[model samples]
Target: MAKLTKTFIDKVEPPAEGYAIHWDDKLPGYGLRVTANGVRSFVAQGRVSGKAIITTIGRYGLFTEEAARKKAQKILQDMREGIDPRAVNKADAAMKVTLQDVLEAYVGRPGKLKASTAAEYRRQVEKTFAKWAPLPIASITRDMVKERHAALVKGGLEGKKAAPASANAAFVTLRILIRFAMDEYRQADGTPLIRDNPVDALKHHWAKLGTRTERYIDRRKIGEVWNKLHAMRGEVQGYEALASVDLTIFGLLTGARRDEMATLTWDRVHMDDHDPAECWWHITDRKRGEDLQMPLSSQAVALLRSRPRLKLADGTESPFVFPSWGKSGRIQDARAPMQAIGEIAGRHLSLHDLRRTFTNIAMRECLIEKFRTDLLTGHKPASDDVTSRSYLNLTRLNEWLTGEVQKIGDWIEQQAAIAASKNVVPLQRSA
Candidate 1:
């Protein structure tokens, strides 16, 4: 046992290390401490009713022997009244877990997650943690999740892309992650990694997407707008030649998400053939099946041919099929082209709407076979089961989808031009 004094600290410097001592020569308990790389923490021990009680006083330099002694004395007093300092710390920590770190950890896990999924996780973390980061994660109560959720629901109504579906998705992923963290905390055998997960109690309460919100572009309007966007491909200033146009065309044609198209490679694509037997895009990271190769229409192949050669990040010549403007990874965004098209065509449209438009056309007009459409859109099959999803595939009718998308872009451009030339009546409808 060492004595506490400024002299003791002066002699302590990492390699030599810090030390602790019992308050008295034989005080029914002891003071314990350890130091590494100059950081230190300590705990004091005392016994009540023959049972021991240990209280961690905090870190070195932060708590001096005098301060630790005072704290220990206080704990001694509490123990005399039957209070356990260790139990108190456990209770206190259970109320201190916060939202920010948990969200970051959840998203940063090492795995090849889906493009839309990665995007979704990132978006939810950014949006939810911004407000709650300051709040202790454990302090986050069921009431808080509800309040935040309600605000988001209302915000969805007034949100930039007000879709209850999107709002519910954000909330659902957040709640699930937090709830998982809770169970993790309970069995924690370490330094109390997590106290409690605030969102666990409310898992069954999230508002359902379809029942809570319904919004999408109409099929005919979708066709009209998509054709216009397709025609405007690869021509805008910020958009690179083949990279930009080819990527959007793939998304429109295959009903793949933008990021999926951005990362698409030749290996994933079988443009040569995709009958009911052969596949077009054998997307490795898609949602439905482990691997799917939909048929490639002549439309999709033409777009692929237009893509310029690219070198992957490793300097290997990439048959990226749709090479990135950056030469590797994926395009930061396919939005620039969509924005340009909307501006030129004078219609306020989004790239994702093109995808939704495709889903609408397929469901309403059988634009593609039902099973084929589900696979293409990454949607669960009609039965939506594992076996049903196994049949999902990415058909290659790129040339047709692109041509159709171009036509849609052309129509939108014409509409925009008309609106510019003539005072087009604002089409307003009740939501």
Candidate 2:
């Protein structure tokens, strides 16, 4: 490239076809180019601070000489300030999106969410997403992510409001959302927009301290929680409706993750699809990662049918077994109904506790055995035999797992009756 002094830019002219300068041209950041294509592009003379830093300005007539000089001078100024021009360009390139925008796109994406599960994301978004929303995409550096993550660990959402586990949930949400952007978007040069996500830098922190979402609540007090849920009353249903009944019962019976049960569609549930000797729920991908096919008991089916034809805004039957609170034919906040039940029970118990309760109850029931029980709970198998159990040509395994879940359901229902005996008087049926 020719010397890019003020005189050079003022008096220098382009060649008939291709322009070149003797000082230096081909090396990046060394020279400017005004190709026959009429594009006036900048080519920096050298790397910035030993890091390659080559960036383009604009087209020839499209970007005036005066405008190009200003941008060039700014780049030089940044270099003088010990701010690598390459880094500044890289940083500027990454700021095309914001943290808030990425998260909203993720949670609001149309698929696989039970109304209740989606609502939980909404709650998380409302609380944490807002705090980081304004941050530029590039500004969401490893340091920023680490600072927030450390705060979550040291105290959780401010000194001690959310648990470490809850804080981790927030982190996971951020990681997945940011990752989505990196995998999806690209730069003007067609390079990947984000080559690396800062979230990956924090994986060690997360791995050493297991995810915040999976803390196992103890079992001894779960019975108390069960009793409370059985005794609680909903507003309109008072202490009596089946909708309220199914909410508490299903959680305890299947040991399926809470949202997994909430998003159940009758079509996915085929209780009558099998012979009496072989009933099934035919559960689908309730958890995001794997394909789960949970067989249902007659009791599971009964609990499911207990709230058939969910409330719809148009007053017609809604497709969802559990409609969205907003009447979008999706489930409303699943945690809300379960939480209400807990509040009524006077325990403030979480729905996840119901899963723990299911595990405990299953442990007590030898009818289902160990690995089979874990299968129904969606926990990974303890052995190869257990892993292969679901794949067996079950003239019996299908019926067997369904029977196991049903047996556990029966045990839970019986205990629920006992718990409610002292609380809610109207026991139309057991949990």
Candidate 3:
């Protein structure tokens, strides 16, 4: 075999199928490998513990012939000593790996992260940690983390101070990433690449950020907000616009999340069940990663009944309750209409605020028990008592929940009527 050279490697032809290897006569166990797919790589072939082994050095254009020979010589020497150079190279690569590399692996692993979670992680990494993407994972120090954390809170990089909540979120994301890397990556000696997570420093000494209070309409103002939302139906023109009004109201009535209401499908809405007790909305997938069957309130059922069924050109009805021509194929956001409704209410509101309003009204006005309120809102039970839960029948529990929710709905209607009367003035003012 001719000694592998740049000129020889350039002229070598790949086999029609499979792969071909040309060994160098001058350098034992050093060779060039060519594949049918037009790949040309330098390789080292040797025996370790009496078993034949072949290890790729690198591609031709990337590694010069002399460099490849030198690498091959080292690899062959290692093999003779019963040490695998590939393992050593892998350990070295692990030490030199970047945060971006670990993130891709962490998110790409099967069942490790949900699509929404993966998307959020990608956003934070790309937007917040762009500068740190290329830094070696092993080289990340506690001081570096503290500096980044301080920089994020001070808004030094972005030119304006960020919200403490936003800064906290970035720090939390980094903590999770570094923790994941520590668990997954290892050094040549099989020890964890990260000894102690630098994020621990922040957790220990940094002044903890307080949780932001959830914004919800006050109990006394629920009537005014409900009446304003009902009036908005007339001001809005299209079916989708009207649907947004209904969706906002439904959010208040049922305490469902924005996506849950927006993405509700017909099949999940069991409106015509023979048993009123059995009538419920089945959320097949929820954020907490479980199926939730929430019994519909009387007002909720009426709202769903009023929605228009959209049909395609083929005469097939659309699956989504709040169908839209938008890219998501459903009513994704109702920010504009919600903003208008909030203005009328005299307080800024969000879709989530509606859910909070439901909970507040149920607890304070309706006098519903906390456990039942939690159940109605699709929150996990605080009491983990197996005996209490076992004795409870789901149908009976739903029946009780439906009654409680109906009380809130009825109260809101009464308030709406009172609010309407205030809008009316006696005609005797002309006298």
Candidate 4:
């Protein structure tokens, strides 16, 4: 062993296998280690409470010999005082676990979270708790949660609406994340880093959301929205804008969820312009995990037939029906188009509102059976009886769905024709 100098370190040869350590003649338990791959690092070796431990000070290039020796002395001194450097490092890492880290862990497991569900959870955390993301999960206090929840309800944020429903939804997502952290991260004594969930403080203060308000478009104004959308479809400039028009109409016609309809591929959509009866769309990512083969109305078929496959920069075609320039290569947001239609129809309307209109027309107008309507909308059956499970599902209802959806389609067309002859009546936008 020799005193480790810069010249000596640079001249040291790496071993052919494993590693070689040259103990410093000047400082006990301090040495330079060279691995087979020529990685040279300074290390401190000492006994901590009877067990021998070695800790790396740093790599040769990053830490000079003099600086490495200083770090080694400090590490050796800490070991003598019964403090294990490994334990200290572990605790430091645990302390730095942030709220964003917890969210990543929560959504990263295979098959635990669906793609759509994961995307929604990420959006909620990124947009709602953006300030709290980088802060350690353990630092989130009950008071902070309560204040943020109230702020969300009051619409204190710049672009957010003062809706208690969205506030409650944000907290629900936070509670899920904190609970996941309680099980995932732990301290020295094996206890969880998070002892109690801060969101639990809002036990009785959660908002009471309702569906009793005007959640759907008025049946009388359906034709007006339909006509306005078609007119806008012709005037829109880009592919994405035009897609917004068709996607909104498709949402109204099929009552499918936004993600389900947005991610539709040409492979999943089977259509025949010659025969409307042969046209149908298949959805594998239903919210309930059920596979559905939904029949398309003549209106839906025409819309799909008109859409051209989006050509990529490389001359290949995109798989999505509604392709966009965004990273996902699919139509993500149609709220702007929906909002414009809402103005003409007399109120603000969401895609879900269009879904409600479809259900309303099917049940209240055509007098279709509730079970058949449920099938068309992909709702779980109220009855779990053997016969309902065995014989009465999507497979058996193909013809019935075709006829029922066609009737709704016919009703919407008739409304459009009648609305053309009368003066349009506009309504106030809801606050």
Model 2 stretches astray by more than 4 angstroms: 1-55, 59-64, 73-88, 95-97, 101-127, 137-168, 175-234, 237-245, 273-278, 286-293, 311-316, 340-349, 365-367, 386-391, 394-398, 420-431
Kindly give the stretch of ten consecutive residues in candidate 4 with the minimal lDDT sum.
Answer: 391-400
| Clash list (residue pairs), candidate 3 | none
State which candidate, 2 or 3, has the greater lDDT. Answer: 3
In model 3, where is the ten-residue run with the lowest total lDDT?
205-214
In candidate 2, what are the lDDT values of residues 274-331, reduced to their tens digit? 4744555545544532555676666667656556575555776655565544533454
Evaluated at residue 407, the lDDT of candidate 2 is 72
Question: Can you rank all candidates by lDDT, best first?
Answer: 4, 3, 2, 1
Deviation of model 1 at 168, angstroms:
6.4
Q: What is candidate 1's CA lDDT for residue 321?
A: 63
Q: Estimate each model's TM-score.
A: 0.61, 0.60, 0.69, 0.75
The runs of at least 3 residues in candidate 3 whose Cα sits more than 4 Å from the true structure, single-residue gaps closed, are 6-29, 34-40, 45-53, 61-64, 70-182, 185-214, 237-243, 272-279, 286-292, 311-315, 337-350, 395-398, 423-431
* lDDT of the candidates, in the order given: 0.57, 0.58, 0.78, 0.83
| TM-score, model 1 to reference | 0.61
lDDT value, candidate 2, whole model: 0.58
Model 2 worst lDDT run, 10 consecutive residues: 207-216
